[model samples]
Target: MKQGLEPAARFAADLAAVWPEDERSGSLGLAVSGGPDSLALLLLAHAAMPGRIAVASIDHGLRPEAAGEVALVERVSGERGIPFTPITVKVAPGNVQARAREARYAALAQWARAQGLGAVATAHHADDQAETLLMRLNRGSGLAGLAGVRSRSTIEDSETILLRPLLGWRRVELAEVVAAAGITPAYDPSNANADFDRVRIRQALAEADWLDPVQLAASAANLAEGWQALSWYAELDWHEMVMRDPDAHGGLGFTYCANVPRVIAIETLLRIIGELGGHATRGEAARAWERLWAGENASLGGVLAVPSVERVEKVGVAMRVWRFRPEPPRSAGH
Candidate 1:
């Protein structure tokens, strides 16, 4: 009994760090896909909170085995006396994994809202984080991409908060936990498919025995904190140095004050791209700023960037200014 209590107590501590006790008073939703990681999460959640949790098995309908997997989760949750919800979602076209993920969260958000649950928890673990970091690094992703998965955040644009208390747990540890409970986890065929980038990365990480996934996950978490701090400062810069342009093209203008740091400018320009319904990579934003600073015009993600110097009578000086607006539609002949 003491041995069982120890793991539960530790899991509870991890949960409290992300989802406070006061926040867990209401029912918490658990995403259980019948995989070993999520099954361990289910067992841990049941052990920690007992009656205050519900289980959700999302069936993407991509494979026939998904139904059996959902049924397994339902049976396990029923054995523990926890409420279970089986949600079937339609995966949108294009990028099967990405669309499936989007649909999964959307369904979970809708279910949680209707159920009035306090928060939803998933089973993203440390190994998953390391894989994500490596994948992003391979693609030359910037800070935001390398930050990996956040422990706690809102689901998409919804108010329902999502939690990942198992970020500190390792894949083998989770598999052991489930095995010790005498439960067989359903294996997803896609996990073994080498066509997926994550599967390939996981295989590579397995071969490199010297690399530590826990340390890599810790680095990703540290990067996440640094990104958040930079973002806060960027907001201040945005408010101080950025203004909405009155041009009919619906543009944004930034005053390139003498003291503006390159980091702040890059972050703020990324914000401008998001606000204008365009997506700009961090490298693209930095290059745009560099060109504008050199008195050259640049275009990025369907937005035109032009730099100029403007005289202001109130300030009694000329200030460097960068204007960003939607690029005009090109003529058909051209």
Candidate 2:
């Protein structure tokens, strides 16, 4: 078992390193799920931050025991004299896990905003980061996807930050912290369900003596640094080489010089499509990139990319332009 106060001190130090100075006066919202990981976070955060923390538990309503699990967290928060709020969110159909996650974060963001909190903290530890990296790797993800969970991030478009203070701590260490605190956390049965890919990955990692969560999490952090560098260069290229097409009908098109590097061109096109509310998968984007590279017109994600002639210094030159035109809505019973 680990020393209880040591974990609390470590969590505080991590938070102090990243906590924005402008938000020093604001309280933080903690998302606790009554599991060992989140419960350990709640206890540690309370010790470190004291009365400045607001606790919240999101009930996805997918399982019969979810309400009871949330109640357990509420009871613990009450014992610690921390204000607790229980939030219930409805999970929509299609992709249950993804939908549930979106709903949970949406609820948490809304609650944090209402409470006037500056940020919401979650209990994603090093083991979770390792699992995320493996999952993305299995899907042949790019560098950005392989970066796994970030220590701090914005939830969608919200200004309220999402902080993962325990990313440096291992799962067993958290369990030990909970045990040292004399707390019995409610177990979530889904964690052991082999049908979930994450559970299978976690089991495999547990059985593999050669794999270490600390090393995997470190690799993910390194990839995150590389991803940041790529994004920085992409943004610089976008500003220098891209502009609004003056001839486009009502400013619907984006024009870019053809002399930019191939990678920057692809990144600029993707960003333009995203800004225009177009949804394109990685495969679709890759195909579009190839078409553009071949000097052929391409259409994807409700956007069309075509070669254009522009007069520069009284000389007509070839340029690439993307126009945003969404497809018409389908009528019922065609």
Candidate 3:
């Protein structure tokens, strides 16, 4: 029941704030998959930024109709005079959905870099955010994972904006916008594949009557807000005890947490180790870290061995991080 162009206007405002390319002229590229969500984004960006945005349809060529749908996307892009770039991809079962998505983004990101574009926008919306939040929570991810998708980000040294203006709107609202604008988008069949966790989550959402979608969507936003605040605090205290933060060696580096308060130091050290551990999600890492600080330098991350000699140590291998306290070597005469 929202009035005409409300979402479009809001979307434009959000993109403008996120990109702000006037300060730095950019030929932004968008990943338009010929779906309602992406199509609406293309339409709004075309209307808002005029020549500043370009549309690219990644024809995964998974379905028989994919190429033709890509043609429709090309036609739409032609209507706006935004150069359409179609990159065809092979979506194989062996590659998996994640592989396909990763490939799509990699190709698009490379294209953006070549064109000297500063931002690339995708059509990830509120429902996507909700599903992602649930997935990360189900995995018992940390507070950072609860933040859901970011509004904007820099990946691979490219200062590209990831604008998700539609992230607050529902699928129904987006569908209405696309229909009212008279755009029929091709649906990706892969979205229904139950093998993928995201697709399964979507199916689950569609069937769940007890769970309120609107409330869950709001909860995602609230979780994102809370996660950001907590991350700031975690980083603030962690920096104090980070005497020698982890280097490119991909393992925990020595830290001087002695000056920090007992409770604060313990938490701060755990955060440091967690950060250094990268994707390692072992509770044992925390225990190993605590043991190191508690006067028993033990090997952590399976390789760097730390034997307490008072000062903490971090090495290329966890089994070698030893506390360096000089022990006098007996002379040959003695």
Candidate 4:
């Protein structure tokens, strides 16, 4: 009993580090899918905050076995006297994994709201973070993508808080917790499917002797810290060097005649594009910023960026200003 309680104690400490005690006194919704990691999360959460925690199992309805998985989680929650909610969500067509993730979060957010839960916690362990970093690195992802999954963030289109307190925990460690509890975790066949990028990456990581998932996960955390600093700097730059161009015909403009760090400029442009109701990936935003910095025109995500020659009264010369606006609609084919 002491040995089993050790992991739960560690989990409580880790969770407390991220979620303050005052705030954690409220209800926390656990997203348990009956997997080893999430089942471990359920056990740990129940032990850590017995009365304050509830369990939720999302059934994406992709596989018939999902019902069994949800039932397993519900049963475990019942045994612990934790409130359990089984949410069934429909994943839209296209990109099975991605769409399922979207559906999962959407359902969780709605459920959290309905339950009046202060936060929703998911079991995203260190190995998962390492896999995410490698996958993004393979695609030459920027700082944000390479930062991997954040420990805490807000759900999209919702005010509910999402937490991943197990980011520092290893997959094997979570599996051990479940094993010790004498629980048989539900098997998800998709975990072994090679068609999925994460499955392939996980297999490669298993075979690669030189790679350490713990170290990789640490690197990703470090990157996340660096990205946070850059984001703060970008906000500062936005306030100082950015303004709405009166002549831009309802758009934004960035004004800087002096030298600015390439990285900071890209982040600033990302902010501007986002504010203007346009979307651009980090790579796309970087390329667009580079073109605009070269005194050229560029377009990204329905937003057009054009350099304008304007007279600066203080400088007494024609300085180039970058103007961003929605791209004009094209006429019939010429």
Deviation (Å) of 100 in candidate 3:
2.0
lDDT per residue for candidate 4 within 153-176, as digits (tens), equals: 899999989999998888999998
lDDT of predicted model 2: 0.83
**Per-residue accuracy of model 1 over 1-334 as CA lDDT, tens digit each:** 1224476787898899999987664688999999999999999989888888999999998999999999999999998899999999999999999999999999999999989999999999999999999999999887888899999889997999999998888899889889989999999988999999999999999999998998899999999998898889888978877777757544454333423678778988888777777898889988998998898998998888788888755456887778777778899999
**Candidate 2 lDDT over residue span 1-334, tens digit each:** 2335477788888787668555665798999999999999998899888999999998998998999999999999999899999999999999999999999999998998899998899999999999999999999988878999988888985777989988888999889878988989999998999999999999999999799888899899999988888788889877876676644346456766555666556677788788667877766777787887677887878777775545443225545544434444568886
TM-score of each: 0.90, 0.90, 0.73, 0.91
- Model 2, runs deviating above 4 Å: 1-5, 20-23, 246-248, 258-264, 308-334
Tens digit of lDDT per residue, candidate 3, span 177-296? 789888888887778889888888888887886866556666777777776665565566666435554556543465443443333443454554454452223355456556766657
Candidate with better TM-score, 2 vs 3: 2
- Return whichever of 1 and 4 wins on lDDT: 1
Q: By descending lDDT, how would the candidates be arranged?
A: 1, 4, 2, 3
Which stretches in model 1 have alpha-carbon errors above 4 Å?
1-5, 248-259, 310-319, 331-334
State candidate 3's TM-score: 0.73
Native-referenced Cα lDDT, model 1:
0.87
How much is the lDDT of residue 295 in candidate 1?
A: 88
Q: List runs of model 4 lying over 4 Å from the truth.
A: 1-5, 248-259, 308-320
TM-score of 2: 0.90
Q: lDDT for model 3, on a 0 to 1 scale?
A: 0.67
